[model samples]
Target: MRDLFEDTATAFALKTDSELERAYFLFKLIGNEPLVRIGTAVTNFAIKANLPVERLIRATVFDHFCGGTNEEECLVVADRMFEKGVYTILDYSVEGQQVENQLDYTFEKTLKTLDFVKEKDAIPFAVFKPTGFGRFKLYQKITEGEQLTFLEEEEWQRVVNRFDKVCKKAHDLDVSLLIDAEESYMQDAADKLVEMMMRKYNKKKAIVFNTLQTYRWDRLDYLKKLHEDAKREHFHIGMKVVRGAYMEKENDRAEEHGYPSPICPSKKATDENFNQVVTYMLDNLDLMSLFAGTHNENSSYLLMEQMQAKSIAKNDPRVWFGQLYGMSDHISYNLSDRGYNVAKYLPFGPVKDVMPYLIRRAEENTSVAGQTSRELTLLKKERKRRRI
Candidate 1:
């Protein structure tokens, strides 16, 4: 069979010649580890020094990767993707805010995104990190079983209230919400809260989705356990599965804390476990909804093949494919063209506030074997085809 991933024309159709060249240049830059390290250091220094670097960053990586700096600005990008049969999931990408006011601002921003998606069928989901709504220390404390003082107890209650408010809004609007997975230390708290939301709002359908990072060795068993609970409680389970980010941080923290790593021992192990979970979810499709959030071509193809074998409808509401915006256009567009439900995780925020997200993207592309090279090859092919 011909490879759907090789369709450069469909993948790059939204790109102009200059955008294609910029993408090519950016991937080439990321492929060099030393250059990326130096560049990241210099960029951080420039930002801290209050230098005028936003324009330079905006003209290059920011434009290629992010939707815009705010919700209204993202509509154009969402419309463009909708025209191509792909949907959007507007994600507010700000991070590391700790003050109460900042946390409240993050919660309000998320509500705004949810409100924006309420009437926009092209935007199927809204997502936020749990840490965005509360202090990371609070989650870690709760996870570690640290007793909270009177003040701390009140703060934790506020965190719960914020989550309930957002999830209630999502349920009322009939818009799905995705709660992102964070690091292991704080993840148990997040998972518990997300499960609570799932039980409350997902009783009828998967209005609230919890993300599962399959790179963790324990996630498969966790999924099985969650499924059992869902069946007993009579609520549908909604999940987005990815191979996982934060692998280096997870391993480093494990070593520092003198704990066995939660991650899979090898890449092959992670891949096999991801596929196994995908198969398991498909087998129980009647009780769950799944979104395969991956950039890996093989994983995408595997999900498609399984769907076909199970005779699932091409646009099944319970099965969807997702990739981050500005990456894996080949998979997103091709799958949508082939009538699969597909969406891009379109992140938006002020440039400075979103730098952490951008930095992680750069690091991910640099570290993932063959990722940048593949992107470079596809951009080059398209540029050559257009004779640009």
Candidate 2:
């Protein structure tokens, strides 16, 4: 295996001590159980102090992982990543709200996000969750297998119109858009929507990408099936593979509902399935474009090995590597250094609004073994280098 420090050292060689300290602070904070448990309390206090939470967010997690709160704000970070030979994927992380005004606001934010990135060559993709700007109850209805009444169906058509506008804007300006994968219960609706959009927009080139969660055993096969469907439908298939984020919830619901859990039996099983899907997608590069989104060292290197084994170019246009903006610099920067297409999944939104995303990251580190420790080690080494 390659030395972990080598890629990181080269990538952040210009970072100052203050930057290193900040990175370390987030690393340790996210890893600490006690600190993260009291996060709401901390956020509440920060809000009460009338602190510029957005600025604090910008300086810390946002600075590390996302582009900005909006498209215009993203340019600074996007340009910087461009300088490092990395690309940016703009994610408008506005979710879990219920207000017509908020929902309309989300649609506007999404449109603005698309308009901003269309001109940037380095930003090859844009992503958003339908839940970000839509009703969760409606999504829940769709998830529970509820048939929409005619008016509800009309509202669904409006949702389609919204997508048409977004995809059309992206298509007119020549940018690819990705629909994120959500909870398993709701994923069917998301998948169907993306497939419909892909059929509508991915004729000449893939303008719509669907996220596939391989942690669910069904999705590896689903990738092949999606490709088959793409073939029959006569449009390109764009897919992003993640190990999945909602394992506990999926399992809990499975038990609560008396259904088989969809998660792979173990982490190894998930990794194996994920790598297999990567290989399958890469082998058929003519028909599909893929994003290998993971922070796992083995999974990332496995793709590199597969590319070499398959004689694909080191920087194949059909494949790219991705990790969340703040949490996986080691993976993102290293892949960029090695002449691979690498992009950080940079999410942007107001601090209070984006707390769910932030909290999930913190919880993920604590739950996933060695994630926080690996990050902390890198931050400390970089800090030590700065001190010297």
Best by lDDT: 1
Expressed as tens digits, the lDDT of each residue in 1-388 for candidate 2 is: 4564246676565356777778788878788888878975777578668876767666777666555666777778778778878888888786786766776777777787777677788788888887765666676788789989998887777677777788888788778787788888877776787888888888887778888888999997888788898788888888988899888999999999998999999999998899899989888888888988998988887888888989999788778888887667777777787788988877887766676777687778888989899888878777676668
Task: Quote model 1's TM-score.
Answer: 0.99
Candidate 1 Cα errors over 4 Å, as ranges:
none
Task: Encode model 1's per-residue lDDT on 1-388: one tens digit a residue.
Answer: 2399899899988888888898899999999999999999999999999999999999999988999999888999999999999999999999989999999999999999988998787898999999999999999999999999999999999999999999999999999998899898899988999999999999889999999999999998999999999999999999999999989999999999999998999999999999999999999987899989999999888888888899989899999999999898888898898999999999899999899999999999999998889888888888889985
Task: Kindly give the number of clashing pairs for every candidate.
Answer: 0, 2
Q: What is the lDDT of residue 132 in candidate 2?
A: 64
Which residue ranges in model 2 land beyond 4 Å of their true spot?
A: 44-62
